[model samples]
Target: MAEKIPAGGTDHPGRGDWPVIPDEREADLIGLDLLDHADGPDLVLFLAGNQFMAVPELLEAFRAAHPKVRRIFCETLPPRLELRQILSGGAWFRGRLVTVVPDCWATVSEAGVAALAEAGRTERGQCRAYLRNRVVCLVRAGNPKGVAEVADLARADVVVSQPSPVHEDIAEHILAMYRAAGGEALAARIMEEKREAGTTLLTTVHHRETPERLLAGTADAGPVWATEAAHAAALGLPLEAVEFGEGLDQRGRVRYFLCPVRGGAHPENGRAFMDFVRSPEGRAIYAKYGFLPV
Candidate 1:
């Protein structure tokens, strides 16, 4: 079983705070936490990893379109972890005394959505693609290692911060892209040889740690979703996105899909939130944060 998120831990942000009212500061709220129904949020979301930057904007737009949904709570976890939590009906978040189920769930991998459907976790015919993205390399500002593309990741001189394939789907995408560029030899070298030599570092929370590693000068570069790199740049962080050429960076579009959870307490509001996410306004909000509209 996957490790449970320790409830009420201050080590990571968004532990105890949840069911927040949408406000101008929404975009700045990027922490994962548990929610309590005692306050009664109108809608709750269990979102896939790496959407920390776009969700707040999406929530704000959702509120504007549906004023009735005044409170929204969300938990952003790795898709597999989120799926496991959904299957189990609730998760034991750090510091949280009880488990809480969400009304809606979104994942970057369609496979995750399919898993939920196969498990009868979502309402039938309710899932849809909402946003698109691609992969890229995130390097420290000025790109100290002079890394430019996926191929350079294979270089002996370029130390890399890599995500764990076991934990994040994006990690598999990265390995595949590397294979496409230089075959399995490249993938093996990075995943095995370089990893053993400490030239390739693995991250526990891929998306969050990429920028942290870069800023801390612990890694020369790391593969990440384009939006993640963009979010870091938008925040004026000392990081730069290095785009890969065609057939190299997993340029074949990745996607974000959402569905209302079946048997959830707030089915009506759940469907409404899904509709708002697919609306033009929702797409615009995603686009503003570097997501390509589906």
Candidate 2:
């Protein structure tokens, strides 16, 4: 059977005991393109998948600061895929269904932000750093895999789950970390050899599926953002974080960037949201969820 993508932070309320969106059912409708029964969202945010845990608190602050803005739509997915959807104005859902375009966008790397600007998707000047994070290995509680470091992922006995480099910017960092820890041969072993042997499973949505793979015993460990692992533990999920050695894991180096989409449907709202994400109050909310704010 093929692996299923978990419902994601969209359905469940997160670690802060706050819902990313006010209503799961309503968010589901929008995600599924099933309902046009209500007014369109005031602000639509396209964000990196790893930041899902902070959405509820971020949205709460956005609402408190801008009370007039009521229906906000936030979509979190891999940055590369999200950028493609943004450039094309929409994304194909189940069987060619198109979802609505978002007003603003945020990515785990500045590369996506730069690409958007270069491609004329978003204004270059408006893009800025929003938050920070680092790579970490998420494992089953108590570290049953004995994955003490990045190199351990290369062991024959370990089965690892990794995100697709085609869609996730984090994949690049993970690969670089692997190369730093061992060498290109080791990187190839895990990225190619082990993958061909079914020992390193590739995930479509890293943030949402990695934890599930760990819980299901299908994946012994996976590289993910430190904040994501923290969020999982905070929610009482059976997962533990394994910090990697400096210079190898790229710890204290990852920076997330955000921008207002050019020619967006709600340019004003996009600007407001861009500002809100950088606001002191907004940074505090993200910090509460383990995200390192700018």
Candidate 3:
């Protein structure tokens, strides 16, 4: 079983503080102890799900800048629901004050930001966008099926793997774009023809997993992040990414944010972290990973 760390303990040097440093041997017990130090009103950033791939370096950078930050807990949830929780002040994680920062695709209009300010809520503007990714058809080493576009997904023998629309918002957005681009009818036709239509294609693979699966011959085609695909190509994944002419809109890219909860314990610390995130140094790190500075 996985080791469980309890919440709320006295502050001391520990392993959890270094999220970027991978543990090669045993689980870092010191790090877990540090998490217990975070208590009441302390800043707890709840990242909108789907941005996990780029978190390691960002966390490392933040920790380097702000050592006083007692604990940094990264949690993930659906974007829409996370937004509602922030707006409604719902209880999350043992009633500790929480701030919601949606992934990149979630865009808050200027009006929404202004409204948040008028309501006397602190706007940290910590969330930053880094990379843009698109769904692609990943095939084995060679073009066996001759798959080219979204329309080709209708081929009787073609096996396509996709993530569930309910959990994978990106997949849903991709499907929406595909339909808007006139591929809807074709998609329906494919489903009707293939009685063994597989929703299992919608497995919980991450952006990196798609490429890995394709290279391993586990999947013929799967959705993958463009940056991950680029990195995978560099690593020689025997895969090719077939881009659909009409792709998901710019809104599909994931964004990261740093927000201060209304009643947070460490408002000052949260603000400091947010400011650092936007500073030249922070922007440099984000840019390194293909993130755009806000």
C-alpha TM-score for every candidate: 0.83, 0.85, 0.60
Q: Between the candidate structures 2 and 3, which one is better when assessed by TM-score?
A: 2
Sorted on TM-score, highest at the top, how do the candidates line up?
A: 2, 1, 3
Candidate 3 residue lDDT tens string, 102-199? 11223222333344445555453633343344455667667677877766666656666664443334555555655655566854654444426642
Can you write out model 1's per-residue Cα lDDT over 24-58, one digit (the tens) per residue? Answer: 32232233332433465667777766877777777
lDDT of each: 0.72, 0.75, 0.49
In angstroms, the error of model 1 at 182 is: 1.6
Clashes of 2: 0
- Using TM-score as the measure, the top candidate is 2
Q: Cα deviation in Å at residue 276, candidate 3?
A: 3.6
Screening candidate 1 with a backbone cut-off below 3 angstroms (N, C-alpha, C), the clashing residue pairs are 5-94, 6-94, 7-93, 7-94, 7-95, 7-96, 8-94, 8-95
